[model samples]
Target chain A: MTGPHKERAVTHTRLDVLRLPLIGLLRRRWGRLALQIPLLAAAVLLVIDGFTGPQMAARNLATVAPWVHFRGFVVLVLLLAGNLFCMGCPFTLPRTLAKRLSIRGRRFPRRLRNKWVAIASLFLLFVTYEALDLWASPALTAWLIVAYFAASFVLEAVFTESAFCKYVCPLGTFNFVYSTISPTQIGIHDPEVCRACVGKECINGSYSPTPLVRLDDIPGGQCEVRHGPEGTPGCGTLLFAPQIESNLDCTMCLDCARACPHNNVGLFVRQPGRELLRPEAWPKRWDVSLLAISLAALGLVNAFGMVPPVYELQRALIKTLGIQSEWLMIGLIFGVGGLLLPFALALLAGALSRALARKKLSLRHTVAAFAPAFVPLGFGIWFAHYGFHFLIAPLTIIPVIQEFLGQPGDWAAFSSTADAVLIGLVQGAGLVLGFLWSLALANRTAARLYRRDAVPGLLPWALLLLALAFAAGYVFSLPMEMRGSLLMG
Target chain B: MSFFRLIAVGLLLLAAAGCRGQAITPTPAEKLSIEMAVEPDPARVGEAALIVTLTGANGQPVDGAKIGARGDMSHAGMAPVLAEAEGGQDGRYRIPFEWTMSGDWFVELTITLPDGSTMTQRFDVSVSGAGS
Candidate 1:
C-alpha cells in the first residue's frame, strides 16, 4: 500500500463473456460435456426415431432436427455468438476416448493438412444432401449421423489432434469459416502476462505430478485458483493463445482458458466482421481465399436448388441433354454452378482488381485479399435463408418430439401467419445489411492496400458482390420449394 | 473422462444398427389408373378439395375405396394436411384439403379397397398463388 503501485483488482470488460458467472462454467474442464451430453442424448433419440418412427420427414425427429432446426440454429448462433456448436459438438463425443486409445498414433499426412480437403468435403456433403434429398428421408438422416460419428472416431483413432475437425468435417469447416463473424473469441487478457510466463499452458496444456491437485510453475493464476481442476488438455487445433488472430480454426473449446495457469485467456467480445477488415489476419494462400469465394457462391447455388424454378431448370436440362438421372442433373448443377463458377468469378474479379490497381499487385494476392470480403454476403445468404426457415416454424420441433414420444400433438397449431411479414422483413434486412457489410469489407480491405485507389481496386468485387446480392434477392423473391416433402421429380 | 466418451461411442453404434430403410413389401399386381383434379383451378392458398378418380383397367369405376390423403409441401419440415375420404359414386374421392402455405406440394394417397388391400400413389401439386 505504501509502494508507488497500488493494488489493482482483476477486472474484465463489460462484453467479456468469460467473466460472466454462468458462462464462466465454460472455463471448467467439464463445461463442454455439460452441453455435449444433452446433444448426444438428443442425437440418440433422433437416430432411434429416424429408424423406427414415421418415415415422413415432417413427422420424424431425425429429419426435422438436422435438416431444419440444426441448420437454422447453427447459422443463427454463428451470427449471434461464436462457435458454440463446435464447443458442444456431439460427433466428437468420443474424441477423448479415441485419443486415449491412439496415444502413440501417427500424425496426419503432412501434405493433407489444409482447408482444401475440407472444401472438397463441403462439396461432397452439399451435393449428396441435395442429390439424395437427405432432408426427406429419416433413415438417410440417421445414417448421416452414424457416418459422422464413424468418421470422427476413425480419424481420432488413427491420427493426432483435431484432424477431422480441421481437415475433414464439413460442418466444422462451415462453422469455423462463418464463426469469424461471431461476437466472441478466445484471447489473452494481457500479452505481457503470457510473454513473462514459462509454462505456456494455454496451448501446451496443464498437467500435474498427480490428479485432483493444482500443479504448475507459476503460483496461483487463473486456471488453478478461479477455474480449478488445473490439469487440462491443450488446444486441439494447435492455436497459441497469444498468436491466434481470428476465429478461423478456433473451435471455442476453451481448452486454452482451462489450461491457462494465468487465467489470461478470456472469451472477449468484439464487433462482428471486424476480422474481415484485417486482410493481414488472413494469409494470401489460395485455399484460404478460394474457400470464402466458393462458399458465397455455394450459398447461392444451394438456395437456387430449393426454389420451384429450379425444377423447371432441371427439366430443361433433362430435355436438352437427355439426362436420365436426376442425380446426374443435380451433380452437374453442383459441380458447375456451385464449384466451378465461383472460381471463374474469382479469376475475373481478381484479374480486374489487379488491372485497375495503380500499383501492380499479384493477381493471386489481390484475389486472396478480397476473399475475406465475401464472408459477410455469403454468411448473410446462409443466415437469411436458414434464419427464414428457422423463424417460420421455429417451434414446430415441439410437436415433432411429441409425436416421436407417442403424444402425436398438432403441428399446424404452432404455425403462424402473423410472423411471416416480420420474418420476411428481417430476412430482407439481413440480406441488405450483408451486402453493405461486404461492401464495407471490400472498401476497408482495398483502402488499406490501395489507399487513394481503393475504389478502382475494389470496383470489380463491388460489382460482383452487387450482382450476388441481387441474385440472392431475386431467388428469395421466388416462392421457396420445400424439398423432401413432395414426391421425387 | 474417456469412459464417458467410450459409452457415447458405443451408443452411437447401437443407434446405427436400427437404421435400415423401411422394407418394400411387394403388392399383388392390379390394373388401376389414378387421376386428380383441384377445385378452383389454379389452386389458391386457402380451403380446397382434391377430386381423385380411380378407374380400373376395364374402365369401370372402382368404388367403396378408402383413401387416406396427406398433402405435404415440397420442402421438408412443414406440417402436412392429413385427411381421409371414402370413395363415392364413379370412384370419385372428394378429399377435403387446406393449402396452409403455398409454393409446391404433393399429396400422397394410400388407397385401401373394401377387400382390405392398400395401394399408394403420389401426385405433385403446384399452387403458385401465395399466402401464409
Candidate 2:
C-alpha cells in the first residue's frame, strides 16, 4: 500500500550521528553473558506450556502470548537486545542435559542423509490430525510434546551438535521464518576488531573450560574443538558469523558476539515489519519453503476445523487407513499440514519466478524469496480462525459453572449473545484483514522480484488459491457435523 | 544512510496506510451485495435459522437467490441446504438449521440476480451447547 521512503535531509542527519558510535557500541560485548540464561528459561517454559496447555489454544494463549499481550515491551526489548529469544531459548536446555549424559560421541549415518525425513514427519502430523480428532484429543496433544523432547534428545545424541535445532526441527524452522520480522539481529559493528584478534576466540569458543592438556609443558595453544567452515570451536551450531550476511542461519546465539575481543556486536532496535519489504536479502530456499509451509499449514488448519466433510473423511481414515492412533494422526496431520502444503506453494513460487524472470533461478533461491512472503498469510489465517473460536467456544463453561454449583445466572448472562455476535463479526473482519495483509505482502515481495505491479496479476490467483483452500476446507468439514441428521429431517 | 532507518520510514508508512484502507470495495457490476447473520447467536446452537439477506446495492429487491446453509462442528465440514422458501418479499432469504451439536460451522450462500452475475458469500459460524 506504500512506497519506500526518500526523505534525504532527515535521513542524512540521523546517519551521521549513529554511524560511528553505533558501530563502536556493537563491538563491545560487556554484559551479554549475564542476560542469556533467563531469556533461555522463558523459552523453555513457553515450550513446556505449549505442550501441557491446550494444543490448539491459539486464541487462549493470545491473551498471554508475550508478543500479543506485551507487543510494545517485547519490541522494545528486542530492539535493545539482540534476539532475546535466542538468548533464553528453552530449546537448548535439553542440549545441555544431553551433554551431561555424555552420550554425544555416537554419530549418525553421514551419507545416508536426507533432511526431508524431518519434513515428512511434520507432514504426517497434519494428516493424522484430520484422521483422528487430535484437535479434540488432549492426550494426543501431550504426545506431541513428548515427541519434541524425544526427537531433540535422540538427534543430539547422534549428531554431536545442534543438528536437530539447526537443520531438522520443523518448529525451529517455523521460528526462524517468523523471526525474520524481528527488529533485533546478531551482527557486527567492526570487521577490523575481528581481524586483529590473535586467537579469534569467539569463533573458537575461547573461554570454554578445556581439558587441561600440557602441550610439551606449555599452556594455552590451539582449541580442541572445531566448528563451521574455518573449523572454529565456538560456533558449535555451525554458523560462521563473518559470512552470516542474513539472519536466516544465525540462531542469534551470542557465542561469537561474546567471544570477539573488540567489544563489538550491539543489538539495536529497528522498524517492525521491515523485513517483509527486503525480499532481495532472503537467501535460503529451505527457510522460505519452511515459511510457506507454515503459512499454508495455518490456512489448512483453520479450514480443518471449519468443514463438515472432514468428520466423514476422518471416520473413513480411521476405518480405511487403519490408522486409529492419534500419534499416527499427529504424524499424518503434520505431514500434510506442515510439509506438503508449503512445499507445493514453494514449488509454485519457483515456477512463477522462473516464468517471470525468464531466467533460471535455481529452485532453491526462488523458494527462499517467495516462501517468506507466506508467513503473514499463515499467521493471519491462524489469528482469524482461532480468534473466532476463542470468542465463541468458552461460553459453554458458564452453564457448567452455574449448574454444578448453585447459581441463578443464565449462562448467556455471563458472556451474553451480544458478546458472541460481536466476537464473530470481529473475528470475520480480522480474517479478511489478515487475508488482505498477507495478499499485500505477497504482492509486494513478488513485485520486487517480478518488477511491476504484481498484485493485479497475482491477487485473483492468490485469492483463488485461498478461496480454494477455504472451499476445500468447507467441503472436507461439513459431513462430520451433519452426520447425526436424518434424511427425513 | 543506515538500512534500519529506511525500514523505519517504510514501516511507519505501512501502518498509516493500513489505517486508511478499510473501505470495502463494492463487488463489481452485475453482482449483488449479500450480507449474512444468524439469529440467537451463531456460536451457540439453538433452534435458530441461519439468516441470509440478499440485495443489490442499486436499490432493488433481489430474489430467487438460492442460499445454502451448512453446520460444520468439530471443524469437520458442512452439508449445505437450500433455504426453504417462505411467503415473503422477493429479496429476503432465510434457512432454518436445527443444529444438533456444537463447534465450528460454515454457511455458504449463492445469490443469483436477474443480471446473471452470481455473488457467493461464505460465512463461518461456531455453535456452543446443543441446538434444538
lDDT of 2 by residue, A272-339 (tens): 34555565456564734664555456555535633554444556767888765655644555556556
After the best TM-score superposition of candidate 1, give how far the Cα of residue B68 lies from its true spot, in angstroms: 7.4
**Candidate 1 per-residue C-alpha lDDT over A1-489 given as tens digits, one digit per residue, 9 for 90 to 100:** 122111111221336687899998877878888888878877887888888887777778888888888998899899898899999998887677685575637778988888889989998988788877788788888899889999999887788778898889999999988998988777767666666566777877775545543434343443342222346777888888776678998888888888887777888887676567766568788888888888988898898987767877877887799887756777788888877888888889888887787768888888888899889899989877887777767777887766665564575676433377887787798889989999988988788888888888889999999999999999887777664422254
Model 2 misplacement above 4 A:
A1-87, A105-118, A124-147, A198-202, A210-236, A249-253, A273-280, A284-291, A312-342, A345-353, A356-365, A386-489, B1-44, B47-132
Q: Which candidate gets the maximum lDDT versus the true structure?
A: 1
TM-score, cand. 2: 0.54
Candidate 1 residue runs with Cα over 4 Å from true position: A1-14, A207-230, A319-322, A483-488, B1-37, B40-47, B52-69, B82-93, B100-132
Question: Across residues B1-132, which tens digit of lDDT does each residue of candidate 2 receive?
Answer: 232443354456444423422223335336466766777774455577766666667867667555544333322111122254332255677677665445555555555444545555667665655422
lDDT of 1 by residue, B1-132 (tens): 556664866577555535434544536327777888987677877889989898988999999988878787745567678888995788898988887766667788888787777788888777755542
For candidate 1, the TM-score of chain A alone relative to the native chain A: 0.91
Candidate 1 chain A least-lDDT 10 residues: A3-12
The TM-score measured for candidate 1 stands at 0.84
Task: Specify the highest-DockQ model's number.
Answer: 1
CAPRI quality level assigned to candidate 2 from its DockQ score: incorrect
